[model samples]
Target: MGNTVIEKIIQAHTADEVAPGRIVWMDLDIRSARDFGGPNVVKNYEREYAGLPLADKSKTYFTFDLCAPACTLKYADNQQACRDFARRNGVEVYDVDSGVGTHVLMEGGLARANGTVVGTDSHMNILGAIGAFGQGMGDVDVTFAFRTGRTWFEVPESVRVVLKGTFKKPTSAKDLTLYLLKVLGTKKIALRSAEFTGPAVAGLSLAGRLTLCSMVTEMAGIIGFIPECGAEARKEIESYTKTPYSPFSPDGDAGYAETIEVDVQGLSPQVAAPPSPTNVKPAVELRGTKIDSGFIGSCTNGRFEDFAEAARLLIGRKVKKGIMLKIVPATRRVYKELLARGILQDLFEAGAIVVNPGCGGCAEGHVGLTGKGEVQISTGNRNFAGKQGKGQTYLASPAVVAASCILGHIAGPEDL
Candidate 1:
């Protein structure tokens, strides 16, 4: 059988023919951990390696993005330990105000296309947008990558997702991803790799591709793959995929465990209701559902394009009375760029509470926490019960969240 993109990538790393279900040790190009997993990874590395030095400090990265600025003393201590370890080991660390770990890695050009990257955060799969093989693992696995230069994996079967049509305006990559989750149902793709193909894939920007891949974690996917586009239209993306690193594409006759087609031309904005990312519904169906707050940022949909789209709808408008709106950039560079463009000023004038770039509010007990009996619409990836506090959370695109903030209800940009 012909090899899928993932299988080809694995073969390139192993220098041997590989197939799904086979275990192989692959050299890692990047190994990363964020605050939540950093300290544990460091502790485990010390305990296991003892006097042995890390395989290569330049290949590892540490970031303080979760609970950044330290929501509690314990969090602060954990971050300090991570900083100390990074300094001692000479590993690069992105501290507070730097940005989400994935964003930092992508924006800094540290994550190379066709490379293998493993991280302590599940959403590390987002790096697949650049044609890299990225997967999430436990702290112990991260420590193993630190101690040695390689990690092992069982090649995963591929799911072929063919995108046929362009998304309608206000119906973004986020909406399309939610629709996929709703169709496939969470866990159906677990331990499998998703290969995005078809005509529409050629038109998706890197930011859009990043948003699409980010939520594959919700489906328990090992990685999301977007093959190199051969057209001149893809020149920008080619910069990261061409030359020294072997660019990967599935063989024409590649075997796939399943094949699904998505026609985005008719797709509408989608929302995942409380307690599950798969509990998705068309945004219009939930219109007029009152919301106490809304958030317009997360690693999934916090790129500059997301903010620009949201600002287009939110400018000259004010958040509804008694309803709170929170805006967070995914990275410090994105934040500064938005500030230079007055996007932050527009959001601030709209009565939005602009917070630092981090994963703070996505989890409960941090900034933007909701209260009992409240409801919120957010752009965050998950909406599980109590994820953001003692309230119901709905997941939507940035445009949908921004519109809901203005209307005080679940709404789409069309409502404005």
Candidate 2:
């Protein structure tokens, strides 16, 4: 049987024939940890190795991404511990104000396409958009990798997802992901690798692919795979994109446990209501639903395109009375680009507050937290109860979130 893209990657790393359901140990091209669990990883490493040096300090990265800028004293201390550890060990660290850890690694050229990356953040699978076999593990797993430079995985079965046609305007990768979650159901994708193919996926920009793949964790997927298209799609983006990654595709007649196809021409903007990402419906269905806050940022949808699209919608309009709109770029580079383009200025003038880059307010306990009994619309990946404070969160595309800010209700860009 022909190997799937993921299978090909694993085989190359191991230099041995491997198949689904088999356990294999492979060398990691990159290993990373973030602020939330990084301190614990450091402690574990110290406990295991004492004064010994890390297996490969240059290959490891630690970033202060979660609760960046230190929401409180405890968070600040945690970040400080990571910083001190990186300094002493000579490992690379992306400090607060740098950006999300995954974005930092990709932008810094550490996450190579067709390479194996293991990270402490589940959403690290977003790297698969570049054809890397990115997997998330626990802090202990990362610590083990730091010590040994190797990790194990049970090769997951593959799910072939073919996207055809074009995404209707105002609908984007976020909508595509939501529509997939709605049809596939989160439970069905658990522990499986999703390989995106067909013409629609080919048309997605690298940033859009990042947005689509970033949310695979929400569906419990091991990774969301997008086969490399070609040189044009593989060109390195300046400042925002730094990595030059080789592309790979599944062999014809590759084995897949299931195949699903989505035609974007008929797809509409979608929203996942409070308490579950799987509770999805057309964005039009949720129109007129009042919201107290709207957010446009996260690893999933915080790219430059997201901010520019949102700024376009909000420039001539003001955030509705009594509603707070928060815009956060995913990285310092993106933030700077937004400022250079006057997108940040336009957002501020429209009554939207542009916060520092990083996972702001998406995971809560940071800026833009909502209060009890309030309603919110966001471009974040999840809307689980209390995920962003005690209020309810409705997940939508960045365009939807931006339009909602203007209407003070859940809405799509078409509503504008």
Candidate 3:
């Protein structure tokens, strides 16, 4: 029987003939936890498992994203639990580096080359950067991965997002995703998989793929995958994979419950109207809308490449007089790399504030939050009302966010 790569992987882990839309229990090949939520997951593990050793901890994975340093307090307290648990059962915990987000870390090795992965955090979809069927689950399910190395999934019907045409303007994958959220409301595809195909996606960088899949959760989808394409994809595959790395694509006859095509030609930068990621409009439509704050950071677009993009635009310029711009790296490693590259100095001299990593201004809970009547442009994942501060939050790509900050208003790279 022919099945999609994702379906085949899931079926290999199960004894049944898996089909789309069927709920079935299967073993998890890998599981990861981050500092943001790892401590609590460990606490739950301690409470539920009670001295029971994991069936095979070797398959269990733990990573110390440690970006939210403050949140590590819980991890500190629970380290013994995690360490002892891992030692007792043979789990591998990554503590040496913090290059990217958890989702990025999970895909570091063969984990990305076509496998079924489950994580404790929502952005687990980023594993799709290398063509993996990955999803986020509750701590309970993660705990099960530690014990029995398995979890359950109701195989999702796929939704194909066919990207056509090359980008005519400076629009980014971030803009494409914002437009997507507008097309597919937040709650419409709660447990579906988003499959990106067509020529547009075929040319995108691996970073672009990560950005697209990372935000799939905002649209309420459980999984996102892009069939492998280009040397960019091959480079990522060779980085962590010892096994043979083969690219995957949907069968020509593979089924999709819905399909949407986005044309990138002449696409303008888009912003999510206040209060919702799905509430979006073209940036040009928001001309003359002054913003008090601008942020460029978060796992979605806080990589070194994102920093380089912003620095390229802000090197000789200053943020507008009335505007306050904040730059956050996704992790300390990214922060240090930017510092080494002198991008840090360029950003600060350009009148932007540099802050510690972690969700940053993305979710609006901390770091450079907005005040009443304040308007901000950011590269964070969502712009839902009060998402960053009670003030207005418009989503844009890193370049757009940096350029808009210098202009004190909504603008794109071209406007710079």
For each candidate, give its TM-score against the true structure.
0.94, 0.96, 0.88
Q: lDDT scores for all predictions?
A: 0.83, 0.85, 0.72
Model 1 CA lDDT for position 206: 69
For candidate 2, lDDT tens digit of each residue in 138-217? 99999999988988888999998887777667888888889888877877778999998876677677778898899888
Question: Of the pair 2 and 3, which is ahead by lDDT?
Answer: 2
Candidate 3, 254-350: lDDT as tens digits:
7777787767655667887787778889878886688888888776887777888889999999899978888877766667879999999999999
Q: What's the distance in Å from true for residue 277, model 1? A: 0.6
* lDDT over C-alpha atoms for residue 362 of model 2: 66
Residue-pair clash count for candidate 3: 5
Model 1 reaches what TM-score against the true structure? 0.94
lDDT of 1 by residue, 33-131 (tens): 988888899889888887789999998999778887887888889889999888888988899878788878867767767778888888888988877
| Model 2 C-alpha lDDT versus the unseen true structure | 0.85
Off by over 4 Å in 2: 228-233, 237-244
Q: Model 2 clash tally?
A: 0
